[model samples]
Each structure stands twice: as C-alpha cells, then as structure tokens.
Target chain A: MGAEHTHGLHLPGQSTVHRLPAHLKIVSTLAFVLLVVATPREATWPYAVHLAALMLVARTARVPAAYLATRLVVEVPFVVFAVVLPFVATGPRISVLGLSVSEPGLVAAWALLAKGTLGVLAALLLAATTEPRDLLTGLTRLRLPRQLVEIMGFMVRYVEVVTGDLRRMSIALASRGFDARSPRQWPVLATCLGALFVRSYERGERVHLAMLSRGYAGSLPVLDAAPLRVGDLVVAAALPTMAAVGMGAAVLTR
Target chain B: MHVPDGFLDLPTSLATAAVAASAVALSLRGARRELDDRAAPLAGLVATFVFAAQMINFPVAAGTSGHLIGGALAAVLVGPWTATLCLTVVLLVQGLLFADGGLSALGTNITLMGVVGVWTGYAVFRLALAVLPRRIGSVPLAAGIGGFASVPMAALTFAGLFMVGGTAPLDAGSLVAAMASVHTLIGVGEGVLTALVVGSVVAVRPDLVHGARRIRAASIQAAAPAPSSGHRA
Candidate 1:
C-alpha cells in the first residue's frame, strides 16, 4: 500500500459555477453551512430545500454522483451516533418490533442526520468545483495570515512526498519479516516513524537552503488575486441568499 | 474524533471558531519568531509529516486497531506553536478536500486538537522532564507524560463544549465520563508510542528532539554543528 491516490478534486469545466471566483465560492459555502447550522432541527423543510438547492448547484457544476457517494462516507460515524441516540435518550417510550425507543431520541436522530448530511454535501460541492490552489487563493484574499497560508500551500505540495516515504518504510519493515499483527510490534513501527521524522526534518532543512539560495526573504511572493466581479458576486450570493430565505421561512413557519 | 457539523450548536461553534482563529493568529506570530524565513516550507513539511504519521495503525486487541494522534509527538519534535500550526493545516486540508470534518465544525476540531492538545502536552512534557534527571534519557518519559495527558485533555475539553452546546439531550456527565475514560486508553497508547519514538530519536540525534534541547546543550561541549544541520552558515 502506498500513499498514491487520485488527488484531483477540482473538476474542470467551462460552466459559470466553475468560473466564479474562489473567494466568493468560499464565502458562499461558509454562509450556506452557517445557515444550515443555525436552523432549528424542527425546521425540517428548510433542510429539504437546502438539499434541493445543493443538487441544483451540483447539476450546474456537473459533479458526478459517484464521487459524492464516496465523499459522503464521512457520515458513517454520525450514522452510528444516530443509531445509539434512540436507545440512550430519555423520553416517552414507543415500541417498534417489540423494542421500546424514546420518542425524543428518534426526533433528535433525524435532526442530526438531516443537518449533518446537508452541511457535508454543501462543503463537498465546494471542493468539487474549486481548484485547491484557488481555495488557498480565496483564503489569502479573505485576510488569512500570509505565513499560515504559505505553510498550507507547502502542505498541499509535499503531503504526497512524506506519505510516500512512509509507505516505503512500512514496506521495508514488511520485507524484513516484521509483521505488525499486535501492539507489541508498535515500538518497531515507532522507531521507523522516528527515522521518518529525521528524514523529513532534514529534507525541510534542505528546502530552507534551497529557498535561501533562491533569495527567499522571509516571505513568499505576495499573491494579488482579486478575481471577483459584480456579476460573480450575484452568482455567489445566490446560494446563501436562498439559504437565508429558507432559514427565515423555516423560523416563521416552524 | 473529528466532530461532525450537527453535533455542536451555532453559538458554541462560533465561540470555538473565534478561539481557534485567535490561537492560530498567536501561533502565526510565534512560528514566525521561531522559524522565520523557514516558516512556510518547513512548517508545511512538518504538517505533511504529521498527516503521514497519523496514518500508521497499531492493533490493540484481537481485532481493534488505533492510529497515532501526533499532537504530543509534534510538540516534542517541534515546539507547541509550530505543532499547533501543523495540526491546523492538516485539519484544514482534510476538511476542504475530504470533508473529513464539516467546515462549520472546523473551529471546534482545531480548538480541541490543536490548541488544547498541544499546549497541555507541551506543558506536561516540561513538567515531567523537570522531575527527572537532566539527561536525554529522560526526554521520552516526559514525552510520554505529555502524550498521556494530551488525549484526555482534548476529550475533556470536547465534553465541556458538548455540555455547553450539544444538540442532543444526552446526559452531560455520562458524556464526560465516557469521553475521558475512552481517551485515557487511547492516551496510554499515545504515551507509549511517544516514548518509543522520542527515545529512538534521542539516541541517535538528540538535537532533533525539541524537548531534549536542554540536555543537548548541557551534554555537548559545543553546538557540535549537528552532523545533519544541512550546513547552516
């Protein structure tokens, strides 16, 4: 097993959704998720509307349903959480298949699943449409600290390198007849990790030297990307604007 | 242990976001002072290393297995400030690309894992090292103390936050107890592995271990030009 996998999250397209500035998409995504988080669990209709609106964006962006299915695997823990809620919750008991479950717990479980799923889909959609570099570019213009953003950029670049080193080390261990079938073998693994750290740190020192030789003067070249336009703002605002409306109607009606 | 979106209420989530944002701000300043020109690429590689390290799995029982959490380990390898940044970067990338934790929940995850975990682990490492002999051998034991405490502290903090803003009406006390006890076991694994890694590194290259710095300075007559310093002028 290696650290290799398809790192390509940004689905390239000529659609307007793909053309929208990264910063605006980031703002819109955050705004949408915030609205979902704020809505009361009883306001279930808003959540359905949120999903419908998300599906519309996904359609426009041409996000593959299969890719999203893989992305939503993050929901498994929440599902397990929802499963236990009914049993642990205290409320009026309702019998189903000869087993009593709390009524309040059932409602709570539905609330968690609905809100959690909507929030995740909204984020995944953002990832699907935006290039990772543009996402960082968006973060930079949003006034995230320059140094932190720079570090994040490096992480994006070098994650594969370090993980590949790890895979090779693990393979080396296996080839030497070391089987990590139990925790007793973790010390050997830990030793390997120690070695890996030394290698990574040395590589970092070499990179520092490389940067210095290239005249890195304590900062990266300033990123001056202001790609958003008035029309793009309206396009970006559409999702959150609808989310805000859904939130208002949810509050008033529910 | 990434908390999903719906678990925490908005007010609680916002509060944590503010807290995480401030801590990151502080860390950016601290890391600049610590790493300076090297902050960008160096911290990036450290973040990548932590990401890679967390993937290593160790079997616990007949079937169960667990992976490294790396906060305490990172604190020992680098300082707490850089370690905090490393974790934030890892968590942010994971959230943006994989949706591993919901964006709305990012603040809470950063607070629990980065700020609370690194600070507590670093503090415990310092305190544990203080009581032991002033030698590199004591480094790993101190790291173990840090690793042991960091996990439960983060878990305890999460339990506290849940009590304040949990969406569900689950009993707060039970949640706290469960979170603390389960993490204590995980912390045991964390502490042991931390000790092992730290010990191994100290044996060969004490200078690489941040927590072993005092001992390295005391034991060596000169900066010794660390055989692996990569030619610092």
Candidate 2:
C-alpha cells in the first residue's frame, strides 16, 4: 500500500500537516487511537465527533479524500469481519432492513468497524505525509532502542532487494513447470522456498562479512538528532485532546 | 497472522505491549553482545528478507494464502536474539509505513510475532536438535517442526488474550479450534521453508547458524580427533 500510494495517491501539497515532525505524528496517532478505543460503543455521538475531527485533520493535512479512501481499502477484511459479527454475536435481537440482527452485536460491529477504520486512516495519513526513511529515523529518535532502529533502517533499505529475489525464484519455478495450484506439486513449491532460503542465508553471510570488514562496532553510530521541538508538542497535543474529549463525553453520556 | 488494532481490547493491548517492550529490552542487551558490526548489517538484510518473504504469499489451501512469519527462520539463520530484533524491525516497518497493522497495536504484534514467535520456535528447534540423533538431516527436520509449531503457538497466545480481553463474545473452544485449524495448515509451509533453508545453510556454512552452532562445533571436534588418530598411528 505504501509503495503504490507513494506514486499515485500522495499529493505534493504545501501544508502544515506535511511539515509536522514524524515522531509527533506517530505519538499523536497513538494517543488518538487510545481515545477512540476508550470511547464506549453505547455512545454513538462521541464516535461521530471523532470521525468529524478526523475529516478536519484530513482537510488540514491536504490529503486528497479520494486518495485517503483508496489507501484505506486495506481495512476491507476487517469490514468483512464486522459484517459477520451481528450474525455470530449472541445478544438481544433487532430488525434492520427486514433482517434480524443482534442489538449488542450491532453495537460491537459498529465499534470494531469505526475504530478499525479510523485507526487505519490515522496510519495512512501518517504514511501519506512522511517518507519511509524519515519514519525510521523518527522511531529511532523516539527511544525505540538503537539495535532495533538500525535493523529497521537496513530492512527498509533492502526490502526491495529481497523481494526481487523472491520474484526471480518464483519465475524460475514457473519456467520449470511448477504449477502451484496442483496439490501434488507441494514438493516443487517446497523446493522453491528451500532454494530461496539457502540463497537468503548465503546472502546474509556475505553481507555480514562485508559489514565486519568495515569498522562496525556492536552499534551503528548515532549521527542524526531527533529534536522534539515545542511546535511538535503542540501539534501532537491537539489530536489527543480532542480524542480525550470524545472519550469523556462517551463515558459521561453512557 | 497480524492482528489489527481494535480487534483486541485495551487491557490485552496494553499488557502485550508491556511484555513486548520488556522482551525487546532484554534482546537489545543480548544483541549488543551478539552483534559486532559485521553481523548487524546482515541482521538488517535478514529482516528485509523477512519483509519481502512476507509479501510473497504462498497459497495454503483452495483460496486461502499465508505469508512467511520468518521468526524461526530468522532465528535459525541468525541468532535468536538477533532474529527478535529483526522481526521487531519488520513489524515496525509494516505498521508504520505500509499501514498493514494498527500503530496502536504495535506492541501486541511485536509480542506475538517477534518475541514469542522467535523464542518458542528457536527453543523447540534447539530441543529437537538436542534429543535427536546427531545427524545433518536432523538439524533441518527439527527446524522444520519448530517453525511449523511456532505459528499456532502465536495463534494460541492471541486466543488467550482475546479470551480475557476481547469485547466480542467468542467461546474459547470455538475460537481456539478455528485459529488452530487454519494455522496448523500455515505451519506446514513455515516448517518446509525453515527446514530447507537451515539445512542448506548448514550444508554450506554450518558455523554461521546460531542454532546449529553447537552441533557444528561438535562435528568439527569429532572430525579433528579422527584425523589426529590416523596421524599418530
């Protein structure tokens, strides 16, 4: 989704949302998700408020609404899970559109659907705004620990290479009359994965030897600074505050 | 089996996050000792490989598809501690950039997929190696079983969390049975890949494998004694 959206959906807009610190964006996104999750399902009004606030942020961020929606298609499976919830959940029954549904189940379904969709959008907006490298740097600065961060930096860098390897292996298998759809062809599929793994392990060995030849101590050198400016705090505070209000209102009314 | 955010309740999410964070803390200390400059970059590449491996979903059954969790495979290829860090990186990247998982649910994903997946799988793989007859084939066989078992173990952990914290009224039996059934099938793919990979690497460079580290050392020692006996006679 990130790759596709980067090329087609992400618009180059001159907006404050785009300029906000990546760490702040990450922090606030978490805060907002907590607020949404804390909000009770019994209270629909608060959720409505939360949704409205998200739209305002989207507008502020200058993310194309269509693009946001397209990116959000990743949440489609959860929607399926939600659609089935009413049928499976045992609760008081009600009728909607001349069909029987569980009352509590409907609420549960709504809760899952709304919160899941909003959470995914929060992420999409973050990605649509920040570059992948900047996000890794931000995570590193967020005190996520150096070992993890360095690994993430390299993982992001080499994902394309590893994926290319998988593609090549799959093509090789296909050329050798390996039809994956047949149940009898499990051995061929297994061999493809086996070959891929051996190649990957060898690659890991060579990469290790290469890194060692360079002056790599236990940790990667920390060079860039991730300063949390006052502006970042201000931007980070806004969404959470709104989310808190949304949750409080849900609790009070319920 | 990435569980998206909000599928789990707050308590479950928070608890899992705490566990994940602590495990990461421990792993960081361990990695500092295990990773010299050379291994660190390779660990990064392995993580990237896991990420790409995940994207290539091998078909499981008629229409269902599953991706590589790569926890056990990573642990077997790299050390377990390094593998934990690698899997953590993969999860973070997937969560933040790809939006494949919920940002809020990052801890839960890491705990189940990274820590539990790597440790449990690696432990089982090691145990199998210990109990089995010392043979090169057994190394991959044990790794295969370990990789297969780890997926359902992760699923079981999720089931436990949901049983406690889930707002949905799913019965424990139905949920576990459903999750186990699907994951057991997924495990087959995991085992095959892990065994084949670990086996091949052992064939080429056994010294590089952390799980096979002891086994390789033992084999080398045994071979050295035989050659020396021939020279002495």
Candidate 3:
C-alpha cells in the first residue's frame, strides 16, 4: 500500500504549473471548482468552454493527456449515476435509440458528469505537481494551526508502519490456516483486527511517553520556513482569476 | 466516503468547511495534550493503517464496492481527539498527495467522514457499551453498531449537500433513500471490520482501546483476589 505512492503516476517535468506555491494552487483549486459548480445545467456551452480551458491549462502545465484520462476513469461511479438521471428525471420525453429519455434530464446528466470530471481533473493536477512535505509547509505558512500541522506530519511519517502491521497480521492469520473466504474464519479476522488496534494503542502510548521525556510542550517545532514569494502570488493568481471570470460569467448568464 | 470536488453546492461546501475546521481546531487542542513524544509517530502509523485498510474494498452488492471509513475504529482505538486528528491527516494527504479526494471538497469530506462519522460512531458505541454486559469482548458489539450507523449518517450528509448544489435531476427523497440503501449494505462491511479490529485490540492491549479501557480495567480488578479486610475491595 505504501509503495503505491511511488508509482508512475507522478512524472517529473520542469513545467510552470509544477513550480507554483501549493497554498495558492489550493485556493485556485477551490475557486475553479466553485466556478464549475456555479455553471448552470442549461448552459452547456459554458461547461464546454470550462472543459476546453481546463484542457488547455493541463496542456500548458505539461500534464499528459493520457494520465488525465486514466484519472478521470476513477470518477466512473458518478458518471454512471449521472447517466441514470435522464431516464428517471421528470420532464418531457424524447426518443433516443427507440427509448424515451427526458430532454432536460439528459442535459442535466451531461452537466453533472462534465462538471464532476473537470473538478476531479483539476484536483489531480494539483496533487501531481506538489510534494506532500512542501504542502504542509504551505499550510503552516497560511496560518493553519501549528498543532494540526504537526499531527499531520506524524501521520504522514507513520502511515506506512501501520499498513505494514496490518499486512503482517493478515499474513500470520493466513499461515495459521485461517481462510477469510468462509464465515468461520471471520472470528479469527475480527480477533486480528482487535489485536492490531491494541498494538497501535500501545505504540501511541510509547510515542507519547517519549515525547514527554523530550520536553515536548503542546506544540511541535516548525520544520521549515515557508516564504510566499512574489512568483508564488503570481502563479496562484492565475488560476483564481480564470475561475472568477468563468464562474462570474456563468452566474451572470444564468 | 472520499467525496471529490463539485459534489456539493458552494454554500453547503463552505458551511461544511467551517464546521470541519472548527472540529479540527477543537480536536487539535485536545490531541496536543494526548501527543507526548511517542504518540506522534503512532499517529502517523494509525493514518497509514487507515489508508491501507481503505484500499481493501469489500463488495457491498455484486458489482458495487465500499471501503471502511475507519473513523469509528480510530476513535475507539485512540481517543476521539487523537482519532479526529489522525483522520484529518489521512484525508489531507489523500486529497493533496494521492489525489484520492478533491482539493476543493476537502472540508466537506472531513466534516462527513472524519468528525461526524467518528463522533457519531463513538457516541453510539459508548452508549451501547453502558447497556451491554461489562466485559472486554463487548467492545466489538459497540464497534459494529457504531460502524453500521455512521455510514448512513455520512450518506445523508452527502445527500443534503447535493440538494443544495445539485446539477442532476435527483429528488431529495429518492436520493436519500437510494444513498441510505446502498450505504446500509456498505455499513455491514464497516461494522464487521470495525468490530473485528476492536475485539482483537481488547484481547491483548485492552488499555490501548479508549472505549474499552474501563471495561478491561474493571475485568482486571474483578480477576484480582479479594482484598484483605483492611484493603479496599
């Protein structure tokens, strides 16, 4: 599970998008998503424009189109749900391939699907570019409370260890002739989970004790400096500006 | 449970963010007290474990798959304060680094799955524990009920948000019913996993389980030989 983080998903490129400040990008991501949400279902062209703009941004950012497609597939559930809306939606019926589907419903479904996919893609692009450590720094700089950030740092560091613990427990259970396929083995699995919790608890206690011994007050020391430069501001401004314009136009039209 | 962006309307998303940020703030204050030197790394481990466990999706219906929310499990194992912080980290990393959740919808996701799910599940678990037999084994029952209940609650929250910003043709009543129905089955998987995890922990390091700590201690006290006449029983 930990190894999944190092997969081929993140391709290093010296692109401008990859160099932007995480905090600004995060703000932009929010604004962009709001713009997508604000776009009316009736105005198909606005959404199309939004999609085209996103593609252009991705292209400029040097995000591989193939990667975007792969990522979009993960939103398939929402897509399926959107597809069903046309049939179930209460509106005037229209014939398509010898079946009746509501015109408004079809339009609504298309909007939902398109908006959801675009939002997901924008988020994916952000994640693809930013490193987790730097993102934490940016959050702390943005006045996200120090304590929360510290806890997040620990979680990022220890998530792998916990996963390893689970994997080992499962393997040990398997070795003991406990097959999870049958109902009878469920008790064993339950027992294993309980054991895992206890281990994690003990680990927490030990960690706490160690921290106490080291003169740890409530807050942790900030790991690195986060200097929000002029460049960061400029890069960050671009996305939000686009989002504000797009969303504002959509709202005005509606 | 990992809601991507654009699922909810702006107002709902913003409101949820405010609620979630407050919850995170309160939890941070409490968690700071809990996180001595040793617990910091353990917090990380807990988050990672959750991430891994979530990947192992259990089939709800034939084709549909649902994964553990892990909020109740985290809260019961660690204290609710620490559990909330742990979940917040997992969600943040998943959203920011792994692209598992949407960046913009982080607030709503944390509100539903982190704060609401854990507190609701843990509260029910504590109540159930009070009514059930005073035994270490009873933690699983509490966990199962907690897990079962939280999923629908989160789904309902999602439905509420959807109603506010929905672009689709879904009616509130039908959406709620459909969401609750699908998530009810998902809750079965959640219940089984949470119970199993809680039960196993109670077996070995009962002191580690925040929810079961009292029962374990009581059981230990009960097992001890009757105190001398001068000694307190």
Candidate 4:
C-alpha cells in the first residue's frame, strides 16, 4: 500500500543488528526457524525463551516494539485457522470459559500458536533489519542458482516500476467511480489487471530487446565477493546459537 | 494459504523443501526451453506482474476480501514453467522481505502455490481447452476452469500434507472438508476474475497469450496452405 516506501517491511536503522551482513542474517534466521520447528512443542519453556531471544534481537536492532507488533498482525490469520482445531480435533473434552474444547486439541493449539508466533517474529526481525536488495545479495552469497538470482534481481529492480503502474491504474479505476466491494465487480477489477498484464508483458518484451542491445548475454555479472569475516559470523551465530542451546536443554530436560 | 511454520513438523517441512527445490530446478530447465535467451528478464518481469496481479483484492463477503492466487492466470499468459518460476520468486521474496510466509515454511509455500497450484491449474486449463474447442476464444473459459479448480486442489493437497506431518492431531475428514470447502468458494471468485482477465488480454493479442499461441499458429497454418486466400488479406 505504501508505494513511496519500496521495501515495505524494512525499517531503517543503524544498530549492530542491522549492520550484520544479510547473508549471515539469512542463514541465522533460517537456522532459528528450523530450530523453532524442530523444538518439542510440548516444552513450554523453550517457546518462551525463543520469544525472549526474538524480542532481544528486536531491541538490539532498535526496531520499535509497537512497529514489530503491528507487523506481527500478518500471523493473525494463522491464529484464526488454528482455533478450529479444538472443535474438529478428536480428543477428551475440556471446558474453557464455559466452552467445551478438546483437551489434546487445546495443547496442540497452544503449541501451534507458540511456534507460529516465534517463527513469525524471528522472520519479521530479519526482514525489519534487512533491505530487499541485501536479502538477494545474501541469497547469491549462499550460492543459489545464478539464473534464479538474476531473475530475482530483475524482480527486485522492477517491482517498484510495476507496482507504480498498478497504483496508477488503481487510481484510474477509482477515478471512474468504481469501487470493487462485491463479487459483482470482479470482472471490472480483473479487466484492470488484464490490461495491466498486457502492458507489463509488452514492456517485458521491450526490456528484453533493450537488454540484448546492451550486451546482456543471458547472464548478469556477479558482485558481493567479499569474504565473510569470522567476527561477523560469530555475531550472526550468536542468536541462533543461544536458541540451539535452549533447544538442547529442552530436549535434555524432557 | 501460506502455511506458517509450526503447522507442519520438521520432517514435513524438510521434505517439502526438497520437493520444492526439485520442482523449481525442473522448471528452470523447462523455462530455458520455453524462453531461451529471453528467459531472465521476461520471467522476472512476469514475476513482478504476478506479484502485482496478486495485489487484486476481491470482495468475498460484505466486509471480507481475498487476494487472487495467480497460477492459472500466469500460466495462461506466460507458459507453465515460467509461471512456476515466477510464483517461486514471488514466494521467496514474500518470505524473505515481507515475512508474509514463514521462513522454514518457504518450501511448503512454494510446493503448494508454485507446484500444486500452477500444475493443477495448467493441467485443467489444457484439458478444458481440449474439451471445449480448439479456438482462441475457448482459452479464457478454459483458464477460468483452471483457476477455479486450482484453489481447492491446493487446499486438498494441503490437507493431505497436514495430515502427514501436522503437529496437531486433527481428524482427516474434517480437515479436508474445511480446507476444500472454503477454498472452493474462493475458487469461484478466482475463476471469474481469471476468465475476465484472460479474456481481456486474449481479445487484444491472442498471440501474446501462451495458451492462445497455438491457436494463432493453427490459424496461420490453416491459412498458409491456401495461397489464393493468403493473397486476400
């Protein structure tokens, strides 16, 4: 919605968390999420520790609690979906707030809620601290396929251009006194997207021709060859390393 | 739906990551055949276009609106392989940048939306096109059918995957019913929109549509043999 702000989730900051290289952050976050998923969902303490670590990172990055909370709203839909488990799941019944819910489903729901929260927050922290371009660079450094990386590069580069076009077209649709508020208006809305698609496709063809003229020989030049420093790796490894410790404890304690 | 982490167990997530990686790799090679040298820029733009297309919010109820999941539309416009690649990038970016889908769940998302969604939609589209007629005008309707079916198919597959690796113990019948039924309704809106959109583009440039390109070629071939008739136009 914020066309002016290209990378919507990223909040600009100068903290040490933001200073970490994106590739390192990407690996660390992935490791954290894997750890979160692999954790014993029944272990209550690990979930709490995971949240604390996430909050600590948010603090270190200087991202506002209010901002992170607002962004965390994306997980609300998953919460809604998980609530149905209690009603549908087959298990011993229990009463909560005068409502009968399955006992096993209740535990499962709690696990889902906890794990989903930690996982989402961990991801949000990375995105909030890193820019989109840096994320791609991180992918490249991690040795994702060259063509895929370049495709992603073009995607990152032209997202604004395409989105700007969409914004303008949306305005044009609004200028005509049309509000897409019901299923009946679907054709009109889709027609707008269709026109957008045609224009974008033509533009793509033109772009290809332009690139061919400019000596783009089916490959983009690779950059970001700087070696990963040991200190930076240690810094990036800190959060995930702590989570790994907590995970080991949780497994051992159980 | 972009399944966030914790919905599926680690084994499931890891398995899906493997599945997603293989599908993306296969699609990358197939797209090279479909696009050749023009693959990089065009597919990238198509990815952005799909990203933009997904921004369309269709009103489902009085207050609720749903976003368009664009496997069929993208496949019909671009080819299926490119659509797969494009959707994968859209998903990867969404995961990395927006935190829209989960980081660990990236493989799951790509598998569902990119592989299941695109291929199911495409298979149905090609089938619909074959069954209905062999003309350009049939492309939109076929695409609509594909779009309509893709959602529920994905939802059904999600139910299956969830059953296999769900962290919770939910009844299979209820799970499938819930996922499939809701997505079936969502599919109606998607189907209509996809049809209208494809119809719009097909009207302007049938040759531009990957689905309709064969019809263009057929029409050209039909005209090619008649030398006298070729002189008239």
Q: TM-score (0 to 1) of chain B, per candidate?
A: 0.93, 0.91, 0.89, 0.95
Best by DockQ: 4
Q: Can you give the TM-score per candidate against the true fold? A: 0.94, 0.89, 0.88, 0.96
Model 4 chain A is weakest, by summed lDDT over 10 consecutive residues, at A1-10
Per-residue CA lDDT of model 1 for B1-233, tens digit only, reads: 78888789999999999999999999988887767768788889889888888888888889788888899999898889999999999898878866778899999999998999989999999999999988778999999999999999999999899889988777777888888899999999999998898888888878788888887777663555466655534
Per-residue lDDT tens digits for candidate 4, residues A48-130, read 88888888898899988898787777788889977887877888999999999998898889988888888878888898999
User: What TM-score does the first chain of candidate 1 have?
Assistant: 0.92
Ranked candidates, highest TM-score first: 4, 1, 2, 3
List candidate 1 segments past 4 Å from native: A1-8, B221-233
lDDT of 2 by residue, B1-233 (tens): 56777888888889889998998888877876665555456777777767766665556678766567889988877778888888888888777877877877889999998988898899999899889988766888899888998999998888898888876766589889988997888888888867766776677666666777777668767888655554422
Task: For candidate 1, give fnat to 2 decimals.
Answer: 0.69
Per residue, candidate 3 scores C-alpha lDDT tens digits across A180-205 of 55444556655655565556656766
Native A-B contacts reproduced, model 4: 0.74
Model 4 bad stretches (over 4 Å): A1-6, B227-233
Writing each residue's lDDT as its tens digit, candidate 4 over B153-211 gives 99998999989999887888988888889899989878888899999999887777998
Per-residue CA lDDT of model 2 for A54-95, tens digit only, reads: 887889988878878877777888888789888777767899
Question: How much RMSD separates candidate 2 from the native structure?
Answer: 3.4
List runs of model 3 lying over 4 Å from the truth.
A1-9, A167-185, A188-192, A199-216, A223-226, B32-39, B59-65, B223-233
Question: Which ranking of candidates, highest lDDT first?
Answer: 4, 1, 2, 3
Shift of residue B11 alpha carbon in model 2, Å: 2.5
